[model samples]
Target: MTDTLLTEPDAGNASEALHEDRLWRDNGWTARVKKNEDDDGWAVEMIKDGEAEPALVGPWTMGRDKKNPKPLDTGAFNTLVKTASEVLRRHEQQLHAQLHKRMAVESGDATIEVTLDIVPDEDDPYALLTAFDSFGEQLAQVKVAPNFKLSRASAASWVENEFRRPG
Candidate 1:
């Protein structure tokens, strides 16, 4: 519930500068605690290396007096970084899943697997709807719009009909 400090002073600048208690930099991330503009409470922001914005921002706990914000420490910094990293990871996973869709349909005596993968290009966004036989051999590949949907019925119809390049 309390902030922990985990940074060591730079070896070269041992006596040149003094470290501040509110800001901490360590383990490829920085944790900073500041007063929240929306209320009298405090907020903590955790930023990873080479990133412009903080990966995580949330309310911070109060100190013993219940007026000032709790101090930032090493333990708190590490926890914040871990949480932020996880959030970034999950977001990437969800986005990847959203861009790729897959299904299988019965076409004649054979089962064909259909996959729709969307390429989010800035100038020209498109999707690739591919069909594979039961043995994993690619049967057909066609380009479609990014908003294209691939379902069992669509797959069955696609297999029933001849494979044509979608316009």
Candidate 2:
């Protein structure tokens, strides 16, 4: 076997370290507390590595004296990470919901699934409405306005009306 060079990971660096001004860094994320521009209070900004925008930014707790912002600690860091991660998760869920809408409608002797997938465009947004039979076979696809609303009644009517492309 050929000789190979290997090095152990930096286990000691797993925890966040306070740099200055309530700033903490660790595990590819940075938590920063700064004076709020609008008021005398403080704000916290959590930024993930390699991203230009911050993952989360919110109010920071004041110290026990209630004059300065609280110092960065491991507990605070973990809470910030959790809150930032939740923000990212909610954003993704909202985006997914906006892009795709699905419903099931009863048709003749079977139930069909209808999905409206929005394709966003700066100039003109549009959506594709697709129908699938009970066996998951594509029945039809039609393009419509991005804001097109679909309901069970509408889907049922569409399936009953010969799958015509909606105008």
Candidate 3:
């Protein structure tokens, strides 16, 4: 898909000169550029096709010309969307791994035994990674879905709450 430049004629000469562009939509991802409401600068909005809202919105930087942008082409916008999605996905996976890695469960041993089993959901893409003990008891579960990000502080708090020992 080719990029289409959509400019508002009534927005005056300054807005017309800004040159807004709308990139292609692929696999539920679309990229568009528009003038920022607050400033003369431009902003890029990455909207997912299936969703009712945009997945990401950020400031759009001008090209080397400084006066104009490089233009939002399909190839460049698609690559950017893919990279952004991948980064978010990996971040979620890493958080899930770290949260489950520190847990352990053990019973009937000279010292208390510890074992941790983390099961990622294959059927449901958005399902959480559930942590289980040696006896198959659930300890904690974290949503590794790209849209559901688990912060380090939240993960640590969950672990503390799950594995808290009585004094």
Judging by lDDT against the true structure, name the best candidate.
2
- Judged by TM-score, which candidate is best? 1
Write candidate 1's Cα lDDT for 1-167 as tens digits.
43444343344543342224566766676677788899999898877666778889999999899998888766777788889999899988999999998998887788889999999999999999999989999999989888887777777777777667643
Sliding window of 10 residues with minimal summed lDDT for model 3? 9-18
lDDT of 2 at 153: 79
lDDT of 2 by residue, 57-109 (tens): 89988889898887777888989999998998999999999899999988767
Q: Which ranges of candidate 3 are over 4 A from the true structure?
A: 1-20, 63-69, 87-102, 110-167
Per-candidate TM-score against the hidden true structure: 0.81, 0.78, 0.45
Cα deviation at 2, candidate 2, in Å, is: 45
Candidate 2 Cα misplacement greater than 4 A, ranges: 1-21, 50-52
Ranking by lDDT: 2, 1, 3
Query: Relative to the unseen true structure, what is the C-alpha lDDT of residue 63 in candidate 2, on a scale of 0 to 100?
Result: 88
Query: CA shift at 147, candidate 1, in angstroms?
Result: 1.1
Better of 2 and 3 by TM-score: 2
Question: Per-residue error at 29 for model 2, in Å?
Answer: 2.4
Candidate 2, residue 33: Cα displacement in angstroms equals: 0.3
